[model samples]
Target: MRNLFPQRVLILFITVNTIFSLSGCVSHSKDNNDLLCVEKNVLNTANAEGSDALVLKNFEARPANGLLKEISVDLPAYESVVYFSTDHRDKILDAANRIFPWAAKDLQTIISKGFKPDPKAAEPSRNGLYVLFKLPNNEFLLLQGIASPDAMSHFTINDNGSLKIKLVTFGTETVSGDIPLVAYAKSDNLYDVFENAWKNAINTEALAGRTAMRHEKEYPEMFTYLGWCSWEQYRRKITSDLMVDAMQKIEESPLPVRWVLVDDGHQHQTGFKMGDSRMLSFDAHPETFPNGFKPLMDLRSEKIKWMGIWHAMNGQWQGLHPDHELRELDPHLIKIDKKFRGEPLPVMMPKGDSISSWMFYKGLIGSTKKHGFDFVKIDNQNRQMRFYKGKENPVKTVSQHAQSLERAAHELSGGLINCFCSDLLSLMNTKYSAVSRVSVDYLLNNMEKAKSHLFQSYQNTLWMGQAVWPDHDMFHSSDKFAGRMMAVSKAMSGAPIYLSDAPDHFLEELVTPLCYSDGKLLRPLAPAVPLPESAMISALTTPEAYRVVAPLPNGAAAFVAYNLAHPTPQQIVKTQISTQDYQHAGSFIQPAVPKWKVPEEGLVYYDWYDGKGGLLNDQYKIELDGFSDCFVQLSPVKKGWSVVGCIDKYLAAAAIDAIEYNQSELKLTMIEPGTLVVYNKKPVKCAMASKVEELGGGLWKIYFPKGKEKVDVTVTL
Candidate 1:
């Protein structure tokens, strides 16, 4: 191994053997006269070249105390560590933010300088390592380990390279305050390293012209919605009544909703197999999709701008599956390695040449695309790396997983690609998919297990093989669903908003505006509630720096705010004017309403009370007592107003105002239990309205009377 330092470094294990509090002193030592702390809890040790000196520890116990997925390293800080857990990216790289400022600064400077272990100089470690620098201050930067996406703590560096993490309080609920803990030196360039690994996700050929639901400015930011729908879910929700109702709903979709992916249903269940696409059939389950894609498929695909399905490549199964029978013919691909609960972890090897891989994927793509899909979510390994032989060729590893999609995209000549449970862009280091899950899969429960979603969204993917997104998977509301949803997306900056809502049925009034797009996520003006709504919330990004804005209806003021490093839910909704943007956009007023306008403000809003199906007639007559906003897509409303709107509750509806609408842009406001309304600042005279269920569409004239007007409108349905 190459020695990266000039001399043998200090190798001390003084795990703060400081029994008694030391008398603060500034005495000179007969040795290296470096700055020294007077406390015995503080012991200085020189770093070395090859020792696993870096260790992860908690202030008190093992809460945020697991292995870290990634970390930075400092030469001579500690010998490289011995980590056996590669399947879960589970290792820690410690850093001395307080004591080793020089090292931190060095790591940043080196990485920023584009330093990396010369490929030729890379020494083989069962665990991959590089003299890599993803940021400036290289020579010793990022040295991350994997800790599965669902891990509780993805990263944790010591505050100082101290071996003891100091803690002043200890209790049952949580150990409060700082506790000195053992840590090794890491570089600040660490994050940029992984960021470079998966940045550039947006510029892919697949999601080129698409946009998130929030950025589509025709409606309220709250009307935006995104979800991950399995092909099975898609088949179930899309029906005749559902379709017609859906068309009406689409007209008032919250955000510009361009992408609605179909997860794990279009392809075969198990892989690591022979190369024919037989097992990986790209068609929907014939049982669920009886009529096939005839009218339902062709017509729906046209109305929605971006749509795709999923494929699981690195999955495992016993001989139970018919496909597993094929694997049984060659069970050698299946083996047990890593011990989980002392039980062997199952693994498998892919059996094929590049052509077979290509052909199989091509078939899958051809099949799915035939059903009217322009986007595809290619799933990855659901097991450990042991399944793929855990080799050093990450390029090969990523290729085995994403190659099919990339090749398929090439064949399709530019289509959206989505990846899950995979190192999506690490293979190409170029913009690949339209959206990608940066953290592990998001479980619906609110769990602050990971960091933050915004951190993952703004990752330095500019150069990494990604330009699409850091998808903060579908949002599930606890009591405060809409509020939490907005926070996560707003935090992601420009990452695409991916959701798992069952389409073809009820539409969700997601509460964040899709504001600006940078190929990643939509930028929002302000986000509302970001705290875990319930035990089911999982934060998957770093809580970086942010500015919070608690928005309320006109005149009614509010001041609820927070200071997270990164804002996730989203920011406040503001103007839609950009330096270079769509020409037809501006403060112009329209005289009439079309069949639909995604998230048209002041329009009628309608939905099943709890996102459930059935008539909402049970909620008692329109109790216009409290200002309530209704949610509906398309409906007739009074004209002659400037900005029209629809909301879920009147209280929410009362929150609407033309804070910044052009006076001549037209005004219309409709509120109460998801009702739609129309707006007209200028006179159009002509009006058209079609009624769908409780949702009524027809033109009525309402001259904006300097004050508010209350009227109970009738629904044709």
Candidate 2:
């Protein structure tokens, strides 16, 4: 609470009132005025007064004092706990957020009803990956666990206020040396603590060289173009003829769709059921395809630049069928070993060796390449743990599977879109993949679910965005419910912009603002992250707007505020935007260089949707209605002038191809013909512009006519 921790030492605290009573005494030191000791099993804080200590009970470290050292402390009382946990243990996929209030006086009631730890599990329970405790004085403590193939970590809060931490090896694999199990950090800023703990966990010796950081990875080429998917339009009923018709319609529409994703429904399966069926072969179903992927791929469309297909990470949701031809490639009938309707479930999977796994995936993806597909959307990738549970070491199995799939896809196709694969193991295994679906499938025509989808997508990006580009999934641009809000968010998300509109349902009005006429999207330079102050607050439970910020090219930043309050609160939710929000925007640029150098003169701020301008040194307040959003842009001023880029697009600054300014002149290069907005203290002359409209407050709008793709203009300052 008093910021007592040293600058470099990360602090994490835990308090426990064990059901199995253990004797512990509290002692104080007169010279230091701090709690010196708390008994045999208790670990005391060095620079704290009162009952501030951490308790460690039943401590056990693997390999007899390995990398993980023993921890013992009697933790002080906390105000509440914020954790991320999943209900499924055997096949841990996704985790959701939960918060529990704590009080020292209500220990009995809190232990009985507030928190309940699950029974001990043979395999590491999917209990939780991250935990945050709010101290009584408003400071925060964070704990982050590592999830890898060789080792897995998780924690649980006991009913008696005890915290149980588990770190174990997978299957029968043994560790000869040290491995990172957990990381800790403390900060008054929740965002700082969460990010620091994650960095520490991933930077450990076991994980450091295996994966690439988000900034180091390159987003797939399809991300720069506007795209469309067939999932929401045709689900599992998609056919060759249906897909051809959809492509024809897309080409005929005014909306410029550059890429097409044939999601799901096109796979060859043996059973009538969807999702539960097993793949019989890599060939397309004869009934639906009639020939193969040729008919759909041969569609004449110059606007469609790239096309891809979807399939599960495994051969299918239930893996390959027993009689599949590829079964000879070291196939194993994995007995799920879990009772389903009083019977053990069986799943077939390829052998987890490097050679066999690589060959299996190469065959499946090669078939797609032969048919002229450019990329793939691999789904359900988080089920690796269940398929190879006892057959091999989890670390090797998961790492091999990921490497095989990524290698095959990268070698044969453009890239892969990873879906349903945000689990800790899967996230850490993304060595070559670039894009990942961060949230569940997009809901249609449901307002409540739509709000939840948006909220989850932004919140999950706090961690998921660190490993790969976060795909918010696809949304229907024609829907009247939340189409505008989704479009605005996508423009700021720095992710691929794709739609799932059915035939003849494309809404040009809503889609036009997201990209140029050539289909290039107006995206931010980096993915949007939750505003630091709003990181700890749950948007769904609180009557407040969830805010996220992204840094744009040219030193501009965009902030989107979403009103996710349910039941439509009567009072308006307001948020403030200032220079503090974009102070770190320069760090997002590549090569460790700042694109838009901030001058001592400060910046010029403006609203994207509304034509409002002001000095960024003063905070700007935004008020929003229920389920709506407000997009604000901040541009730094240089030499008493600022280029606001294209005002027609949602991410206005993204439309500028290049900009250079000096004491007497400013040169601008535009990506497309639009109204270029700039702020200057004096009048300026532009020769290439068709006309110039001058607004008050040093604001000017320069109109460029539609002609060449790249328009260059010189303004005499």
For candidate 1, lDDT tens digit of each residue in 1-717?
112222121222212222222234222233544322334433233322222222212222322222212223223343222111112121212110000001122222222233221111111112222223222233233332221111111222233422222211111122211221122223332222223222111112221232221122222121133333433334324433444344335435543344455444333333333221224234444543455544344445333555555555433221113334333224223332343357543433443345544554565567667777665555443222323322332223334435555557546633443443323222232233444444334334322312233222222222111233334445433213233433333333233454443333333334322221111222322222111111011112222222111122332111111222112335322111111111111101111112122122232222223221111121212111111112211122232232223323212323243333333333323322133333332333312223222222222222222213433333211
Error of 2 at 677 (Å): 1.2
Worst lDDT 10-window in candidate 1:
94-103
Clashes of each: 158, 10
Best by lDDT: 2
Please state the error at residue 231 of candidate 1 in Å: 9.0
TM-scores of all predicted structures: 0.42, 0.83
Evaluated at residue 348, the lDDT of candidate 1 is 36
**Residues 442-483 of candidate 2: C-alpha lDDT, one tens digit per residue:** 767877767767776776776677677788889998767888
The C-alpha stretches of model 2 lying farther than 4 A from their native spots are 1-81, 87-126, 133-141, 160-162, 169-176, 187-196, 272-275, 330-345, 390-392, 584-598, 662-665, 681-685
lDDT of candidate model 1 versus the reference: 0.30
Task: Note each model's CA RMSD in angstroms.
Answer: 18.3, 6.9
